[model samples]
Target chain A: MTTPLVSIDNLTVAFPIGRKLFGPPPMVKAVKNVSLSIPKGSFVGLVGESGSGKTTLGRAILQAAPITDGKITYDDGERRYDIASLSKDKLRDFRSQAQLIFQDPYAALSPRMTVRDIIAEPLEVMGLTKTREETDARVREIAAKCRINLEHLRRYPHAFSGGQRQRISIARTLAAGPKFVVADECVAALDVSIQADILNLLKQLQRDLDLTYLFISHDLSVVAHVCDYVAVMYLGEIVEEGPTREIFANPQHDYTKALLAAIPSLDPDQRSRVVSFERGTVTVDG
Target chain B: MSLLSVENLSIRFKTDEGLITTVENVSFDIQEGEVLGLVGESGSGKSVTAKAIMQLNGRNTVYDPASKITLHGGPDIDILSLKRERDMLPIRGGQISMIFQEPMASFAPAITVGKQMVEQLQIHTTMSKAQAKELSIEMLDRVGITEPARRFDQYVFEFSGGMRQRAMIAMALTTKPRLLIADEPTTALDVTIQRQVIDLMKELIGDFGMSILFITHDLGVIAQTADRVAVMYLGRIMEQGAVRDVLRTPAHAYTRGLLNALPNLDNLDAPLTPIPGDIPSPLERPSGCVFHTRNPELAPGSRYETEIPPMSEIRPGHFAALFPEDVQ
Candidate 1:
């Protein structure tokens, strides 16, 4: 259990801004020298703001983004692969082991496809099962685990509400049986009550499936609720990392402390402290 | 004295399915210089009630004859009586300025941010062009936008998300309206930027001393800004009271459900207890107590399902929709 499912060292992801015929093009480094280890079956949280490079780090680990430098090793007991140096054949194999869930449920799924077809598409593409009968069986199993109603599977995406659509999306992601899942703001679009339901479902599935998760979100309270380990990401770098309780109770970095302080407290008698981010005072790396 | 009062407000939209009542028998009043928070989920009809005050609903929308909205500022203006759009002019930007959730959508893409501010002033007041421009720049600077003179000529797309929201605030406050209706102003921004905007609004409220009808679903934001709180369900006001009294000691079951669903930083280990069911669609709206279907406290055949409970005053200012069957 102590073995790291995902190990990274000095990972960097940069995109070229503009093209100039004369000199080398300027580069925007979305992620810079980030190193972290997600232990097997552990829920690791990555927290940051818009320009903080949390999403970039998640994408870089999946090899969806180009890695300019550094090493990424994903090991899920049976298969060991270096994500940065995967060949076409190995890349296909790596994708089956890892998957990602997006933020918007409305746009995530196709309108024309039925819920059963949408969930079955992943397994079919990955060639996880040989026959249509096996695919149907697997889809039904994942749907039940995600708390999706079996009767609703024959209907289209438009028939469901935002929360229901999100459940369908989760069922699709799990169809391929990914050992590592990167849930990027998965529950941000939902209402508070439904958001709780989805969070509980995710926790239960994590236990039942024995999967590892890298949960990326901007909401600190949500991260504190489900994550076992917390990593605080600032601009292109992780400022701090520790157990969720210790990181929240005794944060070392000033940015982490400021983030925790800014959440509006529920008590009306107390004033929720507002630490305005004065952008001019801080320096940025070129 | 109260600055605005809305009584027995009911709004229904004529849809293909039928007439769907979005807001029903909702009533509340806002005192001068006080912020009243309207809290509700997506189908809760909080926004419909806010828009009904300004007559901003669509063509298919219908308001009941019994609904009455009175603005007690400057002159006693019967808002519902102003049938013509032209009659709505004096109240729209003159007395009540409104800011929306999306800052970019509110602004004109082709025009400079400063020009829009000046245009708003011209529509509401008779200030000279030069005077309006000067005032616009000053207001922008007051909202903490650095180099206001420079930012004045810049388009909205050029500004960052936080800065664009600051520009929106600057525009809304330029007319010096007596009341402001802010609908989810900070929902789209990052937490750090959201804090900045909240602080700016608090400082502005202190300086202007105007009433605000703040509408949003986030309880934390409501706790930070509002003085009084009104919790709304499908189409009814479930609870209303002074912020301290209502939030500290919530009476209605729906209000209790909402608070329980939020992630508590103080009690990290406590499980979030969500209300049992979804907000029923308009076609299947409950007849008596709007939230009876989702109320975890009561089961089927309860009295709440048969009768619409009156909003009884539990304390001096706190009120909740409850029946004697449960209160005793």
Candidate 2:
């Protein structure tokens, strides 16, 4: 097919545990040799339990995490940047194009700043807008797109609820006009009803802005619902990746099957249907 | 007779802003050996209701005079009437024990897991330290902790997330409480671990013949563990009924919205329809029905906006807080 927006080839990220005088210093490989591709304007989900290295891979794609090996290429069909060897100036330019939406809305936003200032901070930091008026206009435009009322712009994050605060965070992420966003567990903290609202907002924003999203979450039902493609991470390795429908319908990996069965079903009659796996059976691969 | 009965329960907290009503006129009952699930969002006051049963709210909490909680195993005891903390000791951990969402917070960091469990047993029962230790080891092994003897001497930090939660469960059940309050115990667990915990709880419930008040925001967990379910919204019970009836045919508009909002595996292509509008802040609670603001079925200026609907019986045992005329 055509060129993908972001392509990862055998990416690896490792952290040294401690200082060593002789031999090799023991290192923990967070993201093992794994390769994946994200089509332009598609919502790709990377799902794994804790310590599965999903978060590290997401950070590596944005060049926020150290790339110990392999390559990551980002292309918007305009300019392609090899993220591993970007210069200071080029990395700054890339920052505006790649953004991150954090999980905890409470901790992500600055409590001291008004909603207006929080959204405008990204634009100001990147020097994307020229004047104060231009910054305000851009902020308001993205705020309106995110469904945040203009009246609430003067209020601090403390005044907003969890769902409203998340909308403000999304507005800030989009204010930078990023082509790709890594929403790491962005909707995990929200109530189910509120989660649907945020998911719909993200999907709507993708259509309106033609944005590519790396939706990182541990909730399988959520990934099945929103993501166009799904990748399963197990112990720093991608055990499975395919279209969401295909993966959900016929999971090839044992870990993927276990995860799907582990989800508590809403139907009361299905209570006895859960497939049980022995403890420590799904531990990380060496 | 029911194991526990809460009648006309109303709870308010004296905050700096004003007296905020967190739970209003809520009432429910749990039979012996029954599991009743209390389901709601963050501000729906499910946690407050659970805490009120244990009398565990902060100092600012004010309970209405009409509120009554009765525990009926031995002599019918009025739980709310026990004004002193010492008088409520037997009910708190002896008759009723609680496990929280965060096991780390509940566990003592400096002490060994076995010490805490034995200490609790000594306080509640006439068990010697040696006997308590033996019982604690057995309990740990029952909860599926490997190397129970070694784990008994370890601190909470030494245990994994799932193991810690299991240890908390083991500690809570060590006393063989008549009623257990599990406030989102599985919410913090991974899905696989959650499955294990849920299975363990079911097995323990059967073995001990104890009732449980399972509070959580997830309907899936409620469906699996609860015999009965109560749906709350903004400090009010919107629906109460058998789990099967509630899940199969939800009567309340808010209940319907909640079920619709969930991403079901049965229909992957179905669009998720969130309940409209954010849950109104407790400070600015609506004038009439608590869920009217976000309920899509209610028209603007409808009677539901001005008058509170009583819990009307739709099925034999299923009740929905809606006008009789509203029921289809």
Candidate 3:
């Protein structure tokens, strides 16, 4: 088989809690011995409830979180880098190849910057373009692809609605021409109608730009709709991973089954069909 | 007669830009012991309608003179006529109680959970301090918070996210209000926790025999809890009907768009069709049908562009705001 765009082997991320100088500090294992591969140009969804370590696993792959143990490698089919021990220069170069789309669009973009500058900031910071004109051209191309109106490029974030602001955020993430993206709950803050629009945009961009996405979200229905492959995380470990259709049709894990059953059905007459499962919170292990 | 009836309700706010009409000519009734779901996206004024029921809108809010909100039982109080805070006391928490999306915000960080609940019971009823304490613990236990006596003495910060929400619900129900306004109570919770909360609420409603005004953007939650549903957009109700009729066979274009937009588990391969355009800002309110901007079925230069369609009864007790030909 061809080399995957991203590969992980027993990846683990841990955070120290209440450290002391005497002995080893207690460590909370945010991500535990997780292994998965994301193929090129594939939309892979990672879903779980809160405290399930889905976000940490996504960040670990992006080299944004502490890799306490295990291996994570990024291969663009051209160059492969060991994310845990990358040099400063290599890490800087890797930043342009992998990006993140934050959950809260309101907090992600700077309120002071106009839409043009916000999207262009990445190009400038990465020094991807030599001239200002080149940066403007790239920003315009991505903004247009994100379905943002050209006339609204001069307006601040406050002027746009939640849906429009999210589009702006997407344009900014794509400005540097990343091959892999981690969209962390990107549409959670938007309304359902707006969520569909954003999801459609992501799918279209994946095809147009040949991009791979590690979509991390708590909503299962969204994962089932957009993802080609699905991974279910529970308490810092991957309990199940398979094709989206197969996972949704026949879930194996108890946690995955409970989550699927918890989605309130739109059929009012099917109220009695709601499966009653034992409810318990998953606390992070230390 | 319904338990609570709101007729010709219009609310305008004095914003920095100009006079913004947030909720316009909206009308609905909640029968006793029935659940009414108010579904809308952001800026749809669903929360404003709930706040108006409690008279909790800010000082700059101006209610239309024709607006009437009458609570049917117990002397048939005219909610809109209440001017003083003292006059609203009996209705605010006595006959009407509200639970918010963020339980942390509703709860006082400094006060113990039990003390606050007991205080509400004392003010609303003639219960003594000792009696209120016992009832507070009982309510907490009823809502499924384990070790209620221990949890009562602790602050909200000490409780988990789910536990805090349960405490908030317990406190709200202690007054035995005839009507409860649950504003996105489960939005902050995980799916499993949300299911538990929904089940607890269903049990409470059955036991207390109180009406609930369930406000949320999630149609699924509405389907599970609400008997009647009202779809809102840009300060207007696009459709109002029985939940089954609205969800299964939505009549209005906006309502149909919302249902179609949701990613259905049953039809995983179907493409999601989002409503065409962004919900227009209040300052740029459309001249006619408020949803004309986002409605895909509306043709250009149609009467919908110039005239607001009245709510027409498409079926018995199912209403859609549409022109005769616009009905699907």
Candidate 4:
């Protein structure tokens, strides 16, 4: 088998609580010892409820969050770099190979920037393109792949709808030509009808570009449909990890079962059978 | 008897663009101890209709004078006719209680959760501070809050998101209002918490004997909780019927599109067929069916472009707005 693109070994992220004015301050363990691996050209889903630290895990992989312990190494079938201890030059190079698609399209994209500039900003900031023409060409190219209308690129973000804004956000993220993409709740804010469109677009892009995706969302139905492999998170730990179908059909963990049972099935004659599960609140580091 | 009845209710907001219609000729009834699910997309006017019943619209809102929004309490007393705050006061928090989408913002930061509940009970009823506090703690525990007394003294930020939502529900139920308007109460919560909250609401409905107008964008939630479901589109009721019938055999094109778009866990590879076009701005609603602009099955005719379509009964108690040729 080919080598894994990314491997995280016993990772932990802790945040200091209150202030260090008095004695040694306590720390909130946002994410505990967790180990996971992402294969090349695979769609992996990380799901959990609030305080699950799924978002923190995603950010840590992208080097956006503080990695308190353990090692995170990324390899693209070439040179490997320690994400936690990246040099300035290595970090700069890592930018072109890894990208993030933010959850809230409304807040993610700059309101003042036009759609063209928003998509082109990453290229210009990274100095990936030589001239304005090159940046414009690259923006148009990715926008087309994302199925965005070229005419709308001239308009500001305010002029577009939620779905359109998300497409614009996707296009901007992909403009960096990253091998791995972390889409954090990318379709959560969109309407159901529009969510399907975005989901399809993401899959098509993944297939066409040979890109790996870390799709993080709270919605299980969406995850079941799109993800190849699934990892269920609870209180910042992976409670279950398996094939999406296997996990959905028979969830092992109580938290995973509760999440599945909570989803109102679309079928009509289906009586919602409330699965008997403990609703015990897990207060970590309290 | 039905607790509330809305007949030919139309609402328009005076926007900078024009008189943007939000609700058009929408009508529904909520019987006592019944849960009605109002399911629709972003522009579906479900929230507007709920707000209209509570007289929560702003100064820019224009409700048709001929419209009938009757809030039936026992038998008589039309809530719409009561203009004075003194008269409407008894109905606002006394008869109808509302819970919003965001619980964090709805609560005050500085005040303790217990203090807020006590203040609401005092204003609406003749309960003393001591009596109110006791009942409030009971309400919190009933909603599955652990250490209710300790939680009562904590600020809103001190409670987790799920706990805060439970507190909101507990506060809403303190008055034991006859009608509960839960507008996307669980939409912001995680799936696990959402299930707990949905179950709690259903259980509360049984004991409280209160009518609920549950508004949400997810049709799946409607199928599970609501006895009946109404599918709204661009501020109009495209389809209204039993949850099973509506989900099994959706009459309107918009309803069909919505069902097709939802990601089905059972069928992993099914392509989500999104509705063709954007939801037309309320200011420029289509001449006939409001959904006709985005509908793929728009019959080729000048009539559809000019004349308005009337809602026709497709099944027993099921009404859908569609042209004859488009009916499946």
Candidate achieving the largest lDDT:
2
Which of 1 and 4 is the better model by lDDT? 1
lDDT score for candidate 3 against the true structure: 0.92
What ranges in model 2 sit over 4 Å off? Answer: A20-25, A276-286
* Residue B73 lDDT (model 1): 55
Model 3 chain B worst lDDT window (10 residues)? B290-299
- Evaluate residue A125 in candidate 3 and report its C-alpha lDDT on the 0 to 100 scale: 88
DockQ of each: 0.75, 0.85, 0.84, 0.71
Which sequence of candidate numbers ranks them by DockQ, best first?
2, 3, 1, 4
Q: Which 10 successive residues of model 4 chain B have the least lDDT summed?
A: B297-306
Overall local distance difference test of candidate 1: 0.90
For model 2, report DockQ.
0.85
lDDT of 2 by residue, B1-328 (tens): 5999999999999999999999999999999999999999999999999999999999999999999999997899999999899999998999999999999999989999999999999999999999999999999999999999999999999998899999999999999899999999999988988888999999999999999999999999999999999999888999999999999999998999999999988889899998888988889999889888888887799988899999999998899999999877
Candidate 3, residues A88-188, lDDT tens digits: the string is 99998999999999999999999999999999999998899999899989998999999999999999999988899999999999999999999999999
All candidates: TM-score: 0.97, 0.98, 0.98, 0.96
Question: Which runs of model 4 end up more than 4 angstroms from their true locations?
Answer: A22-24, A276-286, B299-303, B324-328
Q: Who is ahead in lDDT, 2 or 3? A: 2
lDDT by residue (tens digit), candidate 1, A199-254: 88889999999889999999999999999999998878898999999999998887
Candidates in order have lDDT scores of 0.90, 0.93, 0.92, 0.87
**Between the candidate structures 1 and 3, which one is better when assessed by TM-score?**
3
